[model samples]
Target: MFRNARLSLFLPFLVCVCANGAALAQSLPQPASQNGISYITGGVGEDEVQAFRAAAPGYNLRMTFASKTGSYLSDIDVTITSGAGRSVLSVRTEGPFLFVRLPAGRYQIGAQTRHITETRKIQVPAHGGADLRFYWEDPDRHGVMRVCKSCPDTARP
Candidate 1:
C-alpha cells in the first residue's frame, strides 16, 4: 500500500514536470500551430516571408531607444493585450524575456520608455512562437542596438 501511494505521487510529479517542461525550456511566446494570431517577439520576421502569412497572424517588432549603446534604460512599459483589447502582460523594466499564452487572436503591441511610445499589431498562429525585443533610447541618442552579450542566463533579469 505504501509503495502504491508513493508511485501515485511520483507519477503526478513526472506529469507536472512534463507539462511545464516547455515553460522551462523557453521563457517567451510558446510554440504554436498555424491558424492563431500570435506576436512574433523580438526582431524575427518583419515582412511576409513565410508561406502561410495571411492564413496566420504575427509580427517582427523591436523598440530601439537606450538599446543603441552605453545608455542603459531605467524604465520600460510593455503592454501586451489580446485581440479584444483584454489585458495580458504589462511589463515595466529592462529585465528578462516575457512570454504570454493566449488563444491566438489579434493583438496590439506597444512600448514606452523615457522618450518614446510605439504601437503595432501582431497576428499569432494557433501555436507559433514569436520573438520580440524592446530597446529604449535615451533622450536623443542614435546608434546600433546593442544587447549585453556577457549577460548570463542564470543572472537575474
Candidate 2:
C-alpha cells in the first residue's frame, strides 16, 4: 500500500517531465553546405569521457577535465540542449574520442558524474571550431549529484 501511494505521487512528476521533453524538441538545422552537430567525448582513467557540443553560430570550444596522474574518465555522455531547453544533440562514447557533426545554435552541454551532473552551454559557428567546457567531481565521497555552469570545487570529495 505504501509503495502504491508513493508511485501515485511520483506519477505526476514523471508526466510533467515527459511533457517538457516533448515541448523542447525542435527541428535540426540544415545549412546550404552541411547539417549536424560536432561533438567530442573522452577522458583519461576515472575521467575517461569528455564531451563538447557547439551551435552553428557558436565559437570553437575547448574542454579540459581535471584528473589524477594515471587514471582517466570513461563512459561520458553529453547532450546538447537548445537555449529553449530542447535536446538538439546527444552523444555517448565507447572509445577514447567521438566526433559528431551539428548545426549552429545555442546549446547546453552536460557532463555526467556518478552523483552529480554538470552542464555548460556553447555556441558553434557555421564552419567548425568552438571553445567550450564543463567539469564535475567524482561521486566517490558525496554520493549526491550537484550541477554547475562551470567546474565545481567541494569542501571534501
Give the candidate number with the greatest TM-score. Answer: 2
Report lDDT per candidate. 0.51, 0.50
lDDT of 1 by residue, 136-156 (tens): 543454343447778654322
Give candidate 2 misplaced runs (Cα > 4 Å).
Answer: 1-71, 95-98, 138-157
Candidate 2's displacement at residue 64, Å, is 5.1
lDDT of 2 by residue, 74-139 (tens): 566656677888776565544333344555667777866464567776775666666543444443
Given candidate 2, what's the lDDT at residue 112? 66
RMSD of each: 13.2, 17.3
Per-residue lDDT for 4 in model 1?
100
Q: Which ten residues in a row have the lowest lDDT in candidate 1?
A: 43-52
